[model samples]
Target: MNIEIKVAKKSFNYSGPKNWEETEPWLYAKIFGIGKQLAEKPHALFALPQMIFQIPTNVLQFLFDRNAMRMVGVKDEEAQDEVMGQGYALLKIAQSFANSEAPFSWKVPKVKAAFLGYNYYGPGDSLGMLTFEEFWFAEAAYERNDTNALIAVLYRRDPYRKQTFSEELTEKTLKDLQALPELTKEMIVFNYQGCRLGFSKKFKHVFPKKSVEKDDEQQPKKTKKNSGGWLQVAIGMAGDSSVEFDALRKLNVIVALQMVENKLIKVKQLKRKTK
Candidate 1:
């Protein structure tokens, strides 16, 4: 199948997977929280029956280690030796449409997927909708053909302008969008991937919530500076010094994903999950 993926080594402002514990509290309380959302939404849908056998701690270590190597000089320095760093792989894609009407799924395969904007046709204008070049929005905007899923809207909002995407091909695709009169084919497609979360070695949380007032001026920045994964480790290390505490977690990743599906969480949910 044609999937237009827009992957970055760092996206949603994190270099890699989210910290686990940040996700634990809600996952533990909500879906797994005894008569919470999950139990209510999914009564008959059986879990895929995969019980935890073992989690290779080594793999976890590999995924969470602070890829501490430093790089500052140009290419060909002795310290520029190729070394295996620590981190996990995250792959994602966005979809775009010519007419902005069709719905598409973001599941890699069979997993339950999250829904995107509803009534998203932004303030009626020449352009029917508007969205930032965020990852989830990109995935939610994906367009499909017989062989490939194409994404091009991000390129529209690019630091570098690559193409105008006005072609017969684009016009044909938007023909399926019943929202407006036929548009000239202006859709271009692209995919992104293979990014590593390796750039936050010397940063710290500059702003804490308590210090900042909750007003327009006091509003936290739209994005964070570090690959929030570190914050996750800090959170996990808070109460317990051992894996026992982690294992004691009542809610799992699946439940969290389900909660997201059920409209139970808000913005904080995406920025606060562990791999």
Candidate 2:
């Protein structure tokens, strides 16, 4: 006789990755703080991890250095020429994508992902859902497939529209985003590295209580510019200036891929049939 007993598989809630604060506070900041901006519910759309992982390493390096070099102010016509020479390889890669047959539209995930860390409706509950196009809404549901903890922040204030995850697939949209206008060097550098910005102002005070309350009341209110990455080169937050550039470079690669996955870059169609 054979044993016939079977045990049930245990299923636990998705509590999110462990040690979010210690391990990846930057990622947490995007998933957490950006949503806090709206008076109503706010949701963040992130490119799927598989899409992010597909970016070529050289492209990532180019973007990282491009942003970093700009940050340090690589100026002058001669210097600019030298910079372009250094970026020749990157330019070739970009040209290849431009010549590809697949519509940039094709790169966007058929099923995109979002993260809803806070329940705007109530505790442990959801409100309304949104299609990925709309940036802000009363409430939006996070997709379940957003499992990979990695994300790239699209740093824009209210009404600042860029081609985000299929908002537009026109050549003009691709050109504008590629130029990265209204964006500071820091914003490009840090955001590309996946370091969350604007959270420093919120997360600055660890113990949110009486002391902080008194300080807030006493401090004069000041307007903070929406541009620039708040956490870029923030020694206090990172704990030291010794943080490795290699890691930063790697993280930015995903951000760069997210750019493609969002369809912000135009990939030329391989063949266009004559009408």
Candidate 3:
């Protein structure tokens, strides 16, 4: 939200994030740190405008003090108290704006058809538009925090064509993505994180569940080897054959995940029968 105030006989308008969804991940971390400081020291309220607005410390100090002294009935000694009061009021207003209780989920990006001079499209809201290969590679990139690779996988030049994954295209796209501004990269990552959350919720049954330990006598002990994470999942779906894997990767992500979920349910049923 925008807050307009006059300082040094000049009016200025400053804006802060209106909600958690609007806040950048880096800014959110700074705000989190500020919260801890405020909890320990109420006087930390004076530091908020500087943190939120990212203005010079001296300018903010002048803003508060000048505003405080303008009040009709104020002694010099009372100015400090008035400043603190104003800070507290501002803090409350900011809190009201920033508080968010709803679970965060991905919304369709506002700009869906193009980015950075490239004509491309993202996986539609259902994510059914992505090939399993593209989805898997994007998730792996996200796990590695590789922003360029993730962007390369999730966006494609052809929305209707089922193009095979191309190393040449990806390499060129990575160079293009690297030239993007830092803020643009952050926004892309933020949107992707939300999409991931939505995917997990939609395909919760396909994801591995945390195993609960049982009494030694009540359940047979089982061990599993550490393996490539998403790669391993892909391999299993492909029957561990390279040719089949390539074909499997061409399947739609929604279909691939549904197949995995069905297999998991059948395996569980068979295990119960054996027990």
Candidate 4:
């Protein structure tokens, strides 16, 4: 089945403190470089948690068709499936960019194609997950400057913005985030933490459930079944604030969905053990 992916572009008009063109490009280069280094001979993991974790809006549009999106009283599965189809595709682009082993000098053909495809997912679309939109792009976003420093141009400060993320929540987010390696967590936190911190119930914002189970929560972002594993990098010096867990969880879900669709990960049902 052919899915219609459409995106329209216009020069950003949101007025604030950010000069996105100047700052954002540097951040993007920073993330691609970090993610590129994290990649290995075949698979690598670069540390730019926030950069890639925060899906570029253009890419997201292709993943989710805003024109077809409508929020009813309650979440619906069919609608979710439609959105999920796009969601997975978008996440796949992020992961592929982060996981590919190509050097900084060599851009993968597929990745280049993905960026071109994303440029097409344009102004016609509404951002997926409104809560994240509010936190990352809303008029009063919690974070001022993203890794790209767009926040600096968006506004100087919102005394009201600081009112959103509380002390207790920040502590929890930090502790959980601490558990994740710098290399692995930076990309997750930088791009996702701001949004996830908004909701305490959401698993660091990435796991299916906000309540992290010891068994499931500890699972590495990149799992190795054999000798190969992602290279280690400090997620901290990543230069972006660590994001909430839920956002990371969301990113992971996005990645997992894409892997499944791309046949990178196979789906299987765990049979209930007879008591």
Better of 1 and 3 by lDDT: 3
Backbone collision tally, model 4: 45
- Off-target runs (Cα >4 Å) in candidate 3 are 1-116, 209-234, 240-244
Per-residue lDDT of model 3, residues 1-275, tens digit only: 77765433455667877654566546655654564566688676666656676656655655456454455334355655655565556667656543443224323232222355656655665555778877877888888989888877766667664667776777765665566555455556766766666556666656554454556686835544333344566578678588998888888887887777676677679999999
lDDT tens per residue, model 1, 1-275: 12111112311122211221122222212212222223465431121110011123432232223232232221332322322221212111101111122111110111111132221111111111222112223334442331121232322222222322343423433332323211111111111110001111112121122232355777765544344432243334335655643432222322322333333233346557742
Prediction 2 global C-alpha lDDT? 0.26
Taken over the whole model, the C-alpha lDDT of each candidate is 0.24, 0.26, 0.62, 0.32
Q: List the residue pairs that clash in candidate 3.
A: none
Give the TM-score (vs. native) of candidate 4.
Answer: 0.21
Count clashing residue pairs per candidate.
18, 2, 0, 45
Per-residue lDDT over 2-120 for candidate 4, one digit per residue giving the tens place of the 0 to 100 score: 12332232222221111112224345446645554653632333123225444345444433544434332114556456655655654455465544432211111111112223211
Ranking the candidates on lDDT from highest down gives 3, 4, 2, 1
Worst 10 residues of 4 by lDDT: 118-127
List candidate 1 segments past 4 Å from native: 1-40, 50-164, 176-275
- When sorted by TM-score, best at the front, the candidate numbers are 3, 4, 1, 2
Evaluated at residue 4, the lDDT of candidate 1 is 18
